[model samples]
Target chain A: MVLKDILSIIFISLGAFFMFIGSLGLIRLPDFYSRAHATGKVDTLAIILVIFGLVIYEGFSVNSAKLIIIITFVALTNPTATNALARAAYRFRLRPWFKKDKSKKIKKKMNWEIEIVLFICLLIAAFVSLYVKNLLTAVITLSVFSFFTALIYIAMGAIDVGFTEAVVGAGVTGVLLIITIYRTSRRSSD
Target chain B: MHMFFIYVSVILSVIIFIPLYRVVTGPTIYDRVLCSGSIATSSMVLILMVGVIFNRIDMFIDIAMAYSCLNFIGVIVFAKYLGTLGSRRKNGT
Candidate 1:
């Protein structure tokens, strides 16, 4: 029992570490494609590790069985989602930012100071999405907002609400908005 | 075990903001999508951890499963729609 507990702790911590690294990479990476690479591959592995740790902690039970099912679901869907998003972006003609792209304009660099700062940044993104001139960027920003909201819900112990947000908010809403942009215009005035 | 789950959850919640930073400041639409996708994936793990903390793993597992399916379908639909749009633009229809 002690050994099992120790193993679970080790695995869970490792998972959390990788998850942090993945998110860090999301912020530090240079381009869209590179950011996708960071989030998609690393986050997938982190989730698997975390879930696997939980399965071990629970031992062999109906709950662990369910967790295994979730593992399968996540493992299958994550890459597919990443692939789809990448393909969609490519199809939309959104160019990946490259180091030597001379046409790229300079923008203000983001500094990581505090967690509250991150939350404030999220609020800013939400407002920017509302006011951005590009409809596609607006939709993408909304998707980001939805995802963060889902995380907040989960942290508050509202797992069901978070799940709903994850599915409907981040998932369905993003796709619907993209479809709207496709049928209409990619740019917005003000 | 429960305590460990809580600590991990807190860590994950804190880390969520890093991706949010990307979403906010990302230069392109794809960067936002990718960042959000990362956030979604992490949320899935956090959901299961919450399940462990509350001692209700059974219910949350179902939610996680359904969430994954929805996420997958959403991405595929968006990609397919955009791909069709690109082709339509090319065909001049």
Candidate 2:
């Protein structure tokens, strides 16, 4: 038990460090491309480490194997798809960060307000659904407010749904938004 | 077991928020997409960890597997559409 505790601490701590570094890169990096490097690359590594720690805590369950497999597949595919998209952005003349004053002539164009509103609305709805008294309301609300519910589910140990929600709700939806935006607007509208 | 799971989840939860910020504030479309993809991947692991905590490994495993597949396909489709659309706009067609 002592050995397991120690191992769990090490894995979880390592995962957190990677997440911090990835976020730091997001803030510190000068350009969008570099920011992608921080978020996509380092974040992936951090999650895998965290998952490993969780498996140790669970002590060899059937579901743990599935989680490991999912992690492996993500590790393989995320970077490649991200790279393709980034390269495409560059091909379409998306701007990169510069050492000196840049964007003197570049046009600023993205409207982030819509996204902000969407997130806020989602947040409120998710909270309300959680507090409602019906199991059906809870599950349906979970589908609508999938992201937050999934996090809670993690705490409650509903591993499968949480895993699904994380990927589908957060990951796929994010990618879809980017793809939709790039397609509708030019590569770097803003 | 409970303590072990809590520590792992807490650490993961805190670490992943950083990448989430990047996805939110990313300057370019591709950068945002990449960050999103990374988050998706990370969340998969996090989800599985949650399963371990709850002791419902079998149920969570299926969902995680399906989600990974969806993430991969979604990215490719979006990429292809964007690539083609960019060309169309350039040609003014």
Candidate 3:
């Protein structure tokens, strides 16, 4: 019993350490692709480790079986989601950030310029979406705004609300807006 | 042992801010998507740890599993929808 307890502690702590490292990489990495690589692979492994430790602590039981099922589900879905996101981004023409480019200086300047514009636009879009004449643009801006709000909810430890926000607010709403735009006129009169 | 779980949960919660920063400042929409995915995963683990702290693993495990499924579906939908936007634009229809 003591041996099992010790092993579980070791595994859980190791998992936490990896989780920290993965989040660190997510922040410190320079580009979208690298950040995806960090979160997609490392975070999956970390969750699996932590769950395995919990399973060991629980010993043989129905709950342990459930934990195993959760592990399998996460392992399967995480990579698929990551792949889909990357493919979509690639299709959308978002270039990967490379470290050693010949035109590094020019790229750096452009990066700052675009970052500032996007930051300002993100703030403006929130308020502007409320009063925008065009419904489609308003929907797009609202989705962007909701994405940030979802992150805030998660950080606040409201995981259930965050999950709902991510799915309904960002996912379903975006799809519904697209369908609406397809059906109605693209432009709106104020 | 319960105290250990509580401490670990607190540590995990603090670790979440790292990815939150990325989500807020990510260069592209995809980066934000990735960071949010990471945050979701962390929350799942944190939920499980909370279950441990409260000695209610049975209930929380189900919630965690459902949350994971929802997160996966959300990401897949976003990707599929966004991926086709480019092709549709080029086809001009």
Cα RMSD (angstroms) for every candidate in the order listed: 4.4, 9.4, 7.9
Residue-level lDDT of model 3, residues B1-93, one tens digit each, is 887886777677666556655554455657766776777688788778877766778877876887688668767766776687756656776
| Candidate 1 TM-score over all chains jointly | 0.81
Clashing pairs in 1: none
Off by over 4 Å in 2: A54-67, A101-146, A152-190
Query: CA lDDT, every prediction?
Result: 0.72, 0.59, 0.72
Alpha-carbon runs more than 4 Å astray in model 1: A91-125, A158-168, A185-190, B88-93
Better of 2 and 3 by lDDT: 3
Q: Score the docking of each candidate (DockQ).
A: 0.57, 0.42, 0.40
Taking the tens digit of each residue's C-alpha lDDT, what string does model 3 give over A97-136?
7676332111111222212433443464477568755554
Clashing pairs in 3: none
Q: For candidate 1, give the docking quality class from DockQ.
A: medium
What TM-score, computed on C-alpha atoms, does each candidate reach? 0.81, 0.67, 0.74
Judged by DockQ, which candidate is best?
Answer: 1
Q: Worst ten-residue run, lDDT, model 2 chain B?
A: B16-25
